[model samples]
Target: MNTSSDDASSTSESVSDNDSDNVPVIKKSKASTSAGLLSEHNKDNNEEESINSMHRNHPPSVTLEDMITDICFHPKLDTIGIASITGDVFMYKYNNEETNLVSTMELHLKACRDIEFSEDGQKLFSTGKDLCIAITDVETEKLVRLYEKVHEQPIYTMTIINEHVFVTGDDDGVVKLWDLRQKGSEPIFSIKEVEDYISAMITNTDAKYLACTSGDCLTTINIPERKLHLQSEDHGDELTCLGLFKMESKLLTASNKGKMYVYNWGEFGLHSDEFPNATKKAINCMIPVTENVVITGGEDGIIRAISLFPYRHLGIVGQHNFSVETLDINNDGTLIASSSHDNDINFWNVQYFESLNVTEPQKGGKRKWLEHNLPSSKIHNRSDFFAEL
Candidate 1:
């Protein structure tokens, strides 16, 4: 794996020159094996050119030397911020034609754990296993803020609350809300409500509550009061990811046991609904595609499109040879980016789902992730829409 020091600006070698062309054959350096995790998936798609393998053949993707830990798409562009195990974060501009390295930040002594683009897309916030918090100016590629000792343990998760305020959680379960307007590295409000590390965190649209999931529980903090709102009873499994859908009224947390524990946004204690994963493999990462559809990456290396309300796995979006780690969608709802320990980042065209929501139907979205792709005749991808909203 090449660190920022080794080769930060490595250009994408395999790319199609045009978007209208046939799906490009994006191949990885690693070979596939069924050593383990071969229970149900083995029977689902057995062929090399399986039906679910989207595009003309193999879908378009980038395979870097470094193992990817997390993916954060830009809020306003087609840029992607990738955190690597080598303690560096690389930003790249990608499309169907090319993937060009834009910038690279060597911010931590250990691995960069999480990264978030500010709401305005002006600054990039990152926390790492080095117990540090860094804010980098997007335009200048310079460090604007750095808290060398922001936490006692490694910071695992973080969320942007508003224009000035943001929150972070550490491996020791301490949650700290910080303000850019504040001078010191210390948080404006600090609390420790969970016994285990915070695995994921999300805030509602109103930014009134901060929902955090941990190894065994979920914690909610009232933002206006700056205090713990409620902590749920032990969920008996590690909650890996969090998402809000159904117009932000319903909440769901993915578990290590391959289940979705649903909770009402205001009422945050025990889960009101329990949904099971059809593959029965743990969901490690997720991002909402639309209000009703969420895309999840599972422990079995498959990225899936799942629907709410009826609660069913819609279809496979993409797959890796290793357990999936993170998922993100670009500023445009058309493409979905997912990463796994396999050192590959794959993109799936999801503009099909947006066609169902927008006034005019989108075109170019094909059948690769679902049982069948949406009708491509009218499928197009628009930039103004974001699923997380």
Candidate 2:
């Protein structure tokens, strides 16, 4: 409802400036005031009030820390890897009783933008503003290989489809596929010449399909065919982040203009037939919890749980003081962890409502409450960030 033209324009400008050294100074304008008024009016609406109440009553437990640029959870381990703007990677182990960082890897010369684990969890891959991708052996704590000049600009995201295959997206709007089987080999697949820069890349569990979302569009590639199978461009603005649902059959795309688009993969080839069903605030990151449920974080410092099946707002987690940059859901889909520019990683129990039996009718039934029992650790100190591995 707060669709002010000025606010949208400012958001678009900020996103463009992010890739360059020039920082846009945000000035208060009449459009901003109108946007605020529109937001207040929407908040007072009955339907909006109901949604707001759900968010307020069962708020997610969020721990704030300062600029966390990237976050990843191990596929087979209980450890979560967090990369910071200060060019550090901290591996934190979480268990039933305690959660503490067991290792820190300072291997980058610039802010690390993304970190990922291989399918077997034997190797860790990271990319940064330094325009290089480094592969490290998690157990030995040694750099196994480094791919320098992988991109002409900063690499923003990376995803490992299997032990031998990985993909990276960079600021130059190129998505390059790397094969670990060949030594010093070039990318087996590359999707350059795209109009906008790619912000994220994701692969399905079967590794059959790959999805890439950029500032203005979403593209899907079929790995076997080695060709782009679909490309959709309905989004009128720059897309900031994206997430794939269940089997890569669905997608959630968010733009800097504070609009979210839900699309069916089948309709992608027929781009004109597909239309965005839902819209939200400017989203920075998105992760799917189920085939129909998605959690998204925005610049407004809120994470929203949205259902795609019936297209409803399930709830919201509001606690961060700054924009959430990256987030990931566990493989089991039971927990969600988010990292913010505010410099902290917060993990939340996702089944909070179901655990309370809120889905079932209850008369004189006892309420079951879930607690955040994970040990608290902060990464606010620079010494902890720069410590040697």
Highest TM-score model number: 1
In model 2, which runs have C-alpha deviations exceeding 4 angstroms? 1-66, 270-280, 353-389
- Relative to the unseen true structure, what is the C-alpha lDDT of residue 335 in candidate 1, on a scale of 0 to 100? 79
Candidate 1 error regions (>4 Å)? 1-59, 355-389
Error of 1 at 384 (Å): 33
Q: How many backbone clashes does candidate 1 have?
A: 6
Per-residue CA lDDT of candidate 2, range 253-281, in tens? 77776667766655654332232423444
The per-residue C-alpha lDDT of model 2 at residue 376 equals: 16
lDDT of 2 at 62: 28
Error of 1 at 309 (Å): 1.2
User: Candidate 1, clashing residue pairs?
Assistant: 362-378, 362-379, 362-380, 363-379, 363-380, 367-373
Candidate lDDT values, in order: 0.73, 0.63
- Model 2 Cα RMSD, 1 decimal: 15.2
TM-score of every prediction relative to native: 0.78, 0.71
